[model samples]
Target: MDARSRLSRAIGTPVLFCRHANRLYHRRLGLRRCNAGGVDPFDADWDNLLVLDACRYDMFERRADLPGRLERRESRASTTVEFLRANVDGRDLADTVYVTANPQLHQHRESIEARFAAVVDVWRDDGWSDEHGTVLPETVTERALRAAEEHPNKRLVVHYMQPHYPFVGADADFDGGDFTDAEADEENVWVQLLQGRLDADRSDIWECYDANLDRALPHVEEAMRELGGKTVVTADHGNMVGERAFPIPFREWGHPRGVYTPELVDVPWLVYEDGPRRAISESTPGERDAAADDVVAERLRDLGYAE
Candidate 1:
């Protein structure tokens, strides 16, 4: 084929081919000035690590305003400052990496297995035991504590898998409600719908899912308290509880692909610390006490002990 025809076939359009060719020619001729004075991407401190699962950034933003406390980051440009704030106040923020609950992340058994395995490996390497079926959040927190104990000065990362589906096990000290065959069936149905199996209303399922989050918070709090260091809580992804056009068409459960709609993508970020709290307006002792109180309140609320 002639050069013009070959170029057209390669790019699928003569216009695109010409556009790209012109761009390349300009670059070779130094017509495009390269700017290298931008902000350094690697300037942030990486010594601390915080990982949250099933967390939505938008949700965090909303709750962060509940008490009208100063936000972690006032300007969008101060992400590094936000990270420091999380550690100083022991609060989780939306700055942590958030993995969207895309179809590839948890749609199939293999994918779920792989994702869990990766999380498990991170815990195991940090001295977590695999003999027990500890929840992902607890496992990660325990590992962080162990690391903090050994290194003392190093940053720690804790991962929590909350507000996800399949509410299979008891949460921390909570009575996980009744796990009868009916509940199991319900869980299966929710899972199927999440996985794209059967059509069903997700409102009820989402209620149960939020309950699971309430159930899991105590364990997370316990782990954080034990760490006795800067604690940041956030999520890797969030869930889409029946928003948008995507209904639970199947028995599949959990987050699905193309579902990163606002509902499933927003998460909560909280930070708590036990000592030397110099970042926020709160004092160290006061923040610690408040953190403890918050955990208790969350537990009581989940158990219907509080309004």
Candidate 2:
């Protein structure tokens, strides 16, 4: 009936002294319920947008800064807020869809697979070693592109286990070198932080990461070109490498719990059209010259050109 009685009933606390005290505090602060019911500000049209799970914002930022990386049409703030709001409200954009490879969504796999039947194609890589340990090689983007082409009318949802871990295979080479155990450990920590394990030594870890980027980008580029859509690229989270001088210091590898710092939270996003304009740019004399030397160098280096 009274504020004191209501407070007691709401909190289920029998202490009059504490209840009275809290009432006084709320009165002094002039707190009031603005709305009796929860109302959503966003429309139910979010299901139309293509959602890529496990995308990190920072990684997307860094990738966008690269020389030949694709460009983005949306502002970071808009993207972040929209994504967060949609996720929180469980609203699906009418024209959009979501595709992810996170193990947590295993239960929903069948539904997702069936719902996006035309666009979604699950590729299991049998021998690829990613940050998550041993994974199937077919999960890579190259394979995803071929799958996307198979369904020309549908938008694609590609999930690649990249730069994630185990850094396996000759194709997984970083900075033209295979990673040593110590080096791999060090790099792993760096990636952990970049994906957001810890918060500090990002600069140090970034060097090794940049090299890995050099390795992974080509595959990503090829995939984007093949998809030929308004491709949005990002990571689900980032890693922390030697940030705070704290190595994983444990037998277990990959992103540990609560390591979801901003590093892991950030990701890269790019959009490119696979039409005449992109073709013209690729064929341009200047574009050809710039990409030519770099392509040859990367190929030769990967192929033991010098060795």
Candidate 3:
């Protein structure tokens, strides 16, 4: 077995948490990328790819009112790191520019550089949402617009961190952690719902989720309109709100990777064809910028992840 597989097995994160956590830890270790673990980005045929973080197929099917051909597709992984490793790693990203607001990508920023061509990380200080901890859709829009213009020779992959957590539509902020203190961090919706701080049926909580998605959609629309190619709206993975992942049989609140249930892995593949395809003019390799480790650590902490 290769070192990556041997180390992944040694860690036992896949069996412990799921394949998702294993992938996360693997990426953190700077191990060789694994294509056997998940989806390949180049498999899909599109010029512009918009990934809505934690967006589900059913939720999107019911809520996405935008103009596009919506289809359902199975996702390879059920979490952020898995998605990144599966799609971005081991790919020829020389002609691709990734514009994203998801800090999960930032947490594993180094792995991203080795795999993809360029990444416009908008989840940094200037774009960071003090209220949300994640960059808003508007921020993603501006950066995606900029990335598209800057990397005219590469395909654009705009990833927006909305419909994910720390619900911005409603005041679902996580300042000090006072949750059930489960395996999940205090900030995520899973902990809040488990603690009775948030209600699932109530419109306020659900409405906030809807509003966050709404807030993100327009910016993606703006990017699609400006980029003008075979733009597709999709997601890295889906979310789980009180859905019981079979075999586990208990009620699950948030999307935890490795539990390959339909709710968490089944995502929407919406295609938005804007005129004829435009050929990218040039190619730039992905580069890693000098980042403050402490700043990134704190950002991960705020996002309810281990630093």
Candidate 4:
């Protein structure tokens, strides 16, 4: 172990050390795996790619009642940043238009602006839900419908921040706090569950997860119907709930970067076809609206990412 890790282990809480070790362990694992067997969404056949954030295959299989051919595929990464780094960074994709609700993509704004034909940052718009601490799937659906009409000739990639955290469904009360507040154990639902710091049970947590998916499915279905093309609904990555970290005897909580475990990497690939595939075309890259660094950080924190 490195000196920083040793010192952290010496002075920090056991959970803190485990967090560091787990990241180091899995980052090494990812280097060996190198995302060798994962599916690249760009190479897949689809006119519209709907990315549901932090959604798992098994949960999608059990809860998603959308019409499509659903199959499981290992993702290229275990976290949103890793996903964007592996699949989107340093690529020229001027034929596509991205509509996103997650603010994590801001890190790649320059690349995204230089590559994609257009980027609709719904998160920057008035789509954010301060009450729920996430951009509701319905808001994304509305923006996606408008984007589809506006860019009829371009491939659309709409990313929804749902079925993830700050669960805003009927079971939203299970874990309630300011997602944008300063970092604390209670602010992160997954960590709370992981450390036994919450009063809720595992099954209850699953209900909240399922309810979040339920909240997003209708909006996803709306997008599928209105977009009118080959739409593939998949996730950027899957969430880890009580899954044991491999080669380590600890139960992992949220999706950690570089972790290649099934709970964190395996995601749903639900392909649904409509009228016809879009005649996507390459065009001049468009400008993307910039958010202040503090705003981006606050929104990311709302999504359970701590600096």
Candidate 5:
């Protein structure tokens, strides 16, 4: 094993080390990354890839009114960082430019810059919404459109952090902004629901989640119209809301990495073809500016992730 894997296993032996434990559990179950027979999205044919963060196939199947041939695919991981490590990190993607509102990419920013043609950090570009505590879908849409115009020869990957958390839709009640200022337990709704601290019912949470997805679809459609190409709208992974975990039979809340439940790993693969495909050619890897560690941590917190 490599040094990282060895250290991960050592740290994962303790249940208290949640992150390492999550990784170890997936590894032990033969479900980590490329091991679970999941599709490697980069291998798929597309000129543009639109990723909806924490979006489930079932929810998307029922709700999304966009034009496309929709299908289902098992994702390589159950979380964004895991997906990045599996499908994006350390890869030669100099023909592509990624425009993203998801700050989790900051963890892999260095490697990403060395691999892709360019990366537009929407979060750092005033895309973050102070009122929403997360970047709204519209911000990602506008940036992606600009990226498409700027890098006409490259493939595009637009990742939108929506239907994920902070529930910024009209019906959402727990729309707390500046999550860094909130109490630790209260900042993450999923954590609160898991610990029985959240007062809202599970069904209500599901409704709000659906509402958030509803709020993003129009923006997604708008981007698709503006950036015409052979585009695929998919997700990094799906969310789990009180679904029963495998073997242990415990109910799962949120998308905790390593739990390869269908609710967390199954995602939608919708293809929308318009205009001609871009003539993609890889030049050399490009330079990129990354947000600071403290800034990324704060953004992650605002996006409902603990530092």
Candidate 6:
């Protein structure tokens, strides 16, 4: 955090702390939840790596119905940039193919292309849903299949944007309000949730998040079934839904960079090695579009990300 941000944390109101303090103290203190929590993705054995954006361990455990051994791993970073920076920077990734719905690929496209062999971007503005806020998981799944088939020799990374925000599940138990371009440009769903401005209860908010995952995980299962070799399912980071941070006991929401709390960084690591290939990938960032700079930024903004 900058000097100004730290000072604001020391003096902000409770609601203010809940909304902004998470971003102010953004630094990981190296606290880990498991022994293999922060292992580098490239060093891990596998063929395909499936990334679920902002998925929590407990949430995945509850909803994962795929064929794999499920375990929890501590993510190296809590936000997209940190995840990418910690895992991909300074690494050799020429044999990797990234199929992503997340906008981070476009934001850091040059750096990613520098390390990885190829990137199949599926985040088109044509797929935007006012209710879903980003490209759906199936879009990622279809492109990932083609990418894997075309680049059989390279490692494949499939990144999905879901269970993060703009929650969409068939149950439709909770109304996520409308995250239209204008609404997302103003404030994120997390801030609205923390400020009690949204139309759901705290528990409902979390349920909505889980519901969003439900909408995404089936496509993950589809990829595991189609891809060859060992496939590992994981997340860039987890979300913070009313979790309290230490030292001040302040409540937190959203996945903010620099946070080492379990809620923000602990993600599911499910191995679907039923012949699915394995590989490597992270440096942080997110959103979707036809790769326009401002349109990509708009996707990130829709996800409650400021970068």
Highest-scoring model, TM-score: 4
Put down candidate 6 lDDT per residue, 44-78, tens digits, no spaces. 87788999989888888988888889888888878
The TM-score measured for candidate 4 stands at 0.89
Kindly report which residue pairs in candidate 3 clash with one another: 117-286, 153-282
lDDT of 1: 0.36
- C-alpha TM-score for every candidate: 0.44, 0.44, 0.79, 0.89, 0.87, 0.81
lDDT of 1 by residue, 79-141 (tens): 112222223223332232211111212212222222110112232222322232223445555
Ten-residue region with minimum lDDT total, candidate 1: 281-290
Candidate 3: stretches off by over 4 Å: 1-39, 110-113, 172-187, 192-204, 281-286
Off by over 4 Å in 2: 1-102, 107-115, 118-132, 135-139, 169-208, 242-261, 276-307
> Where is the poorest 10-residue window by lDDT in model 3?
174-183
Model 2, 161-207: lDDT tens per residue?
Answer: 44544333323323423442223333343333333443433343354
Candidate 4: regions farther than 4 A off: 1-11, 29-34, 108-114, 172-187
Q: State the displacement of the C-alpha of residue 19, model 5, in Å, after optimal TM-score superposition.
A: 10
lDDT of each: 0.36, 0.36, 0.69, 0.79, 0.79, 0.71
Across 111-208, the per-residue lDDT of candidate 4 in tens digits comes to 54337888888877488887777799999999999998888899999999988886777533344443223233324667666666655556777777
Better of 1 and 6 by lDDT: 6
The TM-score that candidate 3 achieves is 0.79
lDDT of 2 at 245: 15
Worst 10 residues of 2 by lDDT: 280-289
